[model samples]
Target: MTDDPTPGTRCRACGGAAGTVVLDLGEQPPWDRMPARDAPLPDPAAPLRMWLCAGCGLAQLQTDAAVAEELHGVEPLAMTEQSDRSVGRLARAGLVRPGGRVAEFGSPHGGSWLPRLTGRGMVALDADAVSAAGRADLVVDFYGLLHEPDQADALARRVALLAPGGTLALQLLSLGTVLRDDQWFDLRHGHYGYWSLPALDAALRRHGLGVHRAWWYPLSGGTVLVTARAGAEPDAGTRRLVDEERALAVTEPSGFARLQAAADDTHLLLDWLVAERAAGRTVAAYGAASRAVPLVCRAGLDASLLAAVGDASPAKQGHRMPGSDVPVVSPDELAGLHPDRVLLFLPELLDEVRAALPQVEASGGRWVVLGPGPRAVEPVSALSGC
Candidate 1:
């Protein structure tokens, strides 16, 4: 609650004060705050800085009141839809079962998953909800624990919520993979902490919990499904994954430098977009994802540069982007537009998008991914033809 902009001096996981500022993304607003068509735009961006903890190696951001205010305006409907698949994944992983009591923390809309978990007791609670302890057979928190200032204490409470042998499953961005690729787009105001396997292991062990099983999914760039239980020993698979993260130097200084280098090169994509427009080539964008908001605002992209932003989601279509006046259209409409080049903001969805838009390839419209290094532009010839 200090007035200082750099709010996280201590490690959120271990309460260590030796956290070092590794990457500074300058000032950023809430990436998901989409202003209404006639509403005034939000302004006065807050400082967005990432720190690496020397004690536990957890990467966290400096959050303050301004950042919190910006995040409060985010629409929950889109985020809720994004979690639908992850909920199913949790069920398939054996975390949710018939006759078991399941509790979901930080669910945008309550009862949205009741239909899916029929015959099973389901209770949806906000992140700050308090209730009787030791109640649930399984507790699922999707990208919520990281937002807490005291993640360790929050996790301990979650552990207490589980019955004996019950599981606490978390779905969050894997810093091990994100740092390796320097996906700066994932670093936003809403997420206060980022976890590598080693860091998460350290935090869980501190609270008398151990990772029993884990899975890596391609959702949200790269996500990790970590299931933990009390009084359970870490299995071989968990140890191997932790060792792999160590080999990657996810928490070391060298890794930070590499990530900074890639982040500094973000302007390369912006310059390429500007040049393409200067040359009179039609440029359109793919994916109206919330993550794309920061990229668009940072790069100063607008309708002038991108003719239209196409998304597969029906909810986002017919709406304009948050900060920019760029229209959000359907992928089908984009095919008919026959743009000369389609820019992909979400590179993780590259294959899926390419497969869905065969007409763009048949019309010789190339696709470009906005990323550092060799992942810049994809030629039309490389795409599968109709």
Candidate 2:
């Protein structure tokens, strides 16, 4: 079959060709809300294709032609939950125990662990660190236009500057994890090299550093955190971690087949909804921004079949659903309008949705869920008024 040209056509992790279909998210404009309301409404860029690689099991968007160049100097993209939790975990793990000087590479704006590390007597480095005014307990500033040689040299410098027994925590993305689980969505253009565990371990050893501990942490879908110290004996944890990684397969061709089977069952419920719509029934949806919405929308239910999208987040309430442009409203708004059918977006958030179902039922609405299968017509007993 001729390969479809898509946003993530090139595997973001290892830069290999992404193969096979994992999901088709349909068209969705940028999921991340623009920084300002007036930030010229980005031209609609939805209906994207997401793929899973058979070779490494990485999941990614298929045709992101404009991403690389436009992404340079984009700092806010660095704000990831992976960095925050990793830094926090390491800080409490005696990595920066009192009086220990530390160094971090690619530490953007010294976000997450840097400020605390500075307080704990550690220094940071970045492009600005080379300036006389750039001195700190830590000193990492942009090296400007980095190559592997530059990275190796800078890391060596940082290691040399560390106080003896002090630790170094480098939080670069791990290609090993991306390959291990095919979490290609975690790969963005900002990062250059895709560091594998063996490759990174070898580099650290060359720089006269020893891996203290390393483990794959699910910070951003998936990531790896490595804590190292200069000249320390290799940690036993590294070997165990590698063995475990090699044991896992990135892709399960059978799993997607199973998911498809489940999806096929879901179509039956969608057919029921269509029949009801043809008979002129009203239905509303709960949990608009969820991935489930795309699946539901793709199933072909019309606007009248899904009256409006309802969400608890005030941030999303008035916004529009990605591809469908279905208007989003509040859960309370659903109660006021009292649509006859309520399709739950997050079936896992069922308890919460169930608890709120009474208000809908009291106002003459019936509950329905398009889940592993679709069924309807009852308020959950969990809520008081139900």
- The ten-residue window of minimal lDDT in model 1 covers 67-76
Q: State each candidate's clash count.
A: 0, 30
lDDT of 1 by residue, 183-263 (tens): 876677667778888888778888778777767666656677788887757678777777877887778655777666666
What is the lDDT, from 0 to 100, of the residue 129 in candidate 2? 48
- Name every residue pair that clashes in candidate 1: none
Each prediction's RMSD to truth: 4.8, 8.5
Question: What TM-score number comes out for model 2?
Answer: 0.52
The sequence of per-residue lDDT tens digits that candidate 2 reaches over residues 1-386 is 12445534555444456476544444444433312222343335544454555544544445442221211211222234445566566767756555544444553222455665667665545532444434323322221112232345555666665544556566555555544433332322222244555545655677777666776665433456766666655567778775565454224333333333443354676777788788777778776533444454446554556777777666666555544545677778877667877777545455556565567766666677653456774565434454
Q: Give stretches of model 2 more than 4 Å off.
A: 1-8, 21-47, 53-56, 65-249, 252-255, 259-266, 275-281, 290-293, 351-358, 361-370, 375-386
- Candidate with top TM-score is 1
Question: What's the TM-score of every candidate structure?
Answer: 0.80, 0.52
- Per-residue error for 241 in candidate 1, Å, reads 1.0
